[model samples]
Target: MLKLAVCVSGGGTNLQAIMDAIDNGTITNARIEVVISNNKNAYALERAKKHGIQSVCISPKDYESREAFNQNFLAKLDSYQVDLVVLAGFLVVIPEAMIKSYRNRIINIHPSLIPSFCGTGYYGLKVHEGVLNRGVKVTGATVHFVDEGTDTGPIILQKAVEVKQDDTPEVLQRRVMEQAEWIIMPKAIDLIANGRVTVSDGHVRIHE
Candidate 1:
């Protein structure tokens, strides 16, 4: 069985999707061992508690530097014996130490189709706003390995959602979550947990 850890910084809609997938047996051989959050008030923690999953809140303010925070965070993951780390609405840039230690073991879900309205400043509704501002006919979500660069990791899966006229950022965000993010993130997790995904030559190939 694969021990899973989820990190979050906001409302855990993506976290919920993962849990739902696991509950429905869509993701086999994996169990969410812990849910970690940088914000104590984050609703993701509450979701974890509701499901009886172990929850940890590690405030960055408690640590002096990013390296210190990463060390403590890595310790928690190690203590849990986590095999996979999922960033579900986690906002902070993952530190180099954690990135290096986890490597392809960490995955994240980005709101917009990556290489588009993504990277440093693109998150939450800002991504949807950017897509609308650019007048893109379609936008979606990307699940990728967590690399040092922001959302620049090798893509695992992408599902596109139509951008409708008169759509507000909030509306588009919801649509993308329902149509894309919620679908592919869990599927990507399933593929990884089941040993069906391989990363080679800076790309991912899923076995049939």
Candidate 2:
């Protein structure tokens, strides 16, 4: 089985989606080996525990430096022999070393259609607020490979959600997240698992 490790920093709705997909055989040949969170109280840890998957907490404050934190984090992942790393609402910027170690094996589900409302300071409700503020007619979710840059990795999948005239950031976010759970993240992981994903020339190609 292809082993996957999921990292999270929030409620982990995406994590729950992946778990549901796995339980329903949507991801046929993979196993979720572990779920790690930087915050001990993150609901994702509880979700993982409920599924009987190993859950770990590695707080950033526990380490002296970013390098040390990343080194220890990488070591923990290595122990699991993780074939893929999924960032489900994980808030921290992955260290360069960890990014180098995982390369194309790491994937992240950003809350917005990236390259637009995504960067160092954009996340969660902030991204949704940006979208609403911009008066965009449409906005949605992005699933992409993780690079050293912030949410700048090659996109694997995206789904558009129309911005209603009266939609609040919370409502818009909810709509996008619904699409993410049912479509974006699962499709991206499927592409990887089926050997249809290839990264070349700074792009991700999903073979038909």
Candidate 3:
């Protein structure tokens, strides 16, 4: 089985989606082995505990430097023998070492249809606000393999949500998240788990 380690920094709705997918057999041949969070009080930890999964808190504040924190974080993940790393609402800028170690094996769910309103400062409702403010006709979610750049990873899946004329940030965000949890995330993981995805020339190709 492909063992997955999920990292989170918030409420963990996306992590819940992954858990539901695993329980429903949508992600066959894989299991979520651990859920790690950088926030000690993040609700994701409680969610993991409820599901009887291993929950760990490796706050950056606990270490002397960013490198040390990342080292400890990677060590914990390595101890679990994690095959895939999923960043579900995780907020930290991943260290270069972790990025090098996981490479294409790490995946993240962005709140926007990326290469659009995404980067170092764009996250959560901020992305939705940017999309709505830009007067774009459509915006949605992206699930992609993690790379060195912020949300610039090879795209694995995207689901678009039409932006209504009167849509507020909260409204658009709720709608986007609905599609995110139900569509993009599951499809991305399935592609990776089934070996249908490959990264080349900065793009992810889904092979038949």
Best by TM-score: 1
Q: What TM-score do all the candidates reach, one by one?
A: 0.97, 0.96, 0.96
lDDT of each: 0.92, 0.88, 0.88
Worst 10 residues of 3 by lDDT: 179-188
Candidate 3 lDDT, tens digit per residue, 1-208? 7888999999998888888888988877788899999999999999999999999999999989988888898888889988889999999888888899988999999888788999988998899889887899988888998989999889988888889999999988889989664677877787788888999998989998
On a 0 to 1 TM-score scale, where does candidate 2 land against the true structure? 0.96
Name the regions of candidate 1 deviating beyond 4 angstroms: none
- Candidate 3: residue 208 Cα off by (Å): 2.5
Global lDDT of model 1: 0.92
Ten contiguous residues with the weakest lDDT in model 1: 90-99
Runs with alpha carbons beyond 4 Å of true place in candidate 2: none
Clashing pairs in 1: none
**How far off is residue 78 in model 2, in Å?**
1.0
- When 1 and 3 are scored with TM-score, the better candidate is 1
Instruction: Summarize candidate 2's per-residue lDDT along 44-155 as a digit string, tens digits.
Output: 9999999999999998889998888888988988899998999998988788888898899999988877789998889889998999899999888898899988989988
Worst 10 residues of 2 by lDDT: 179-188
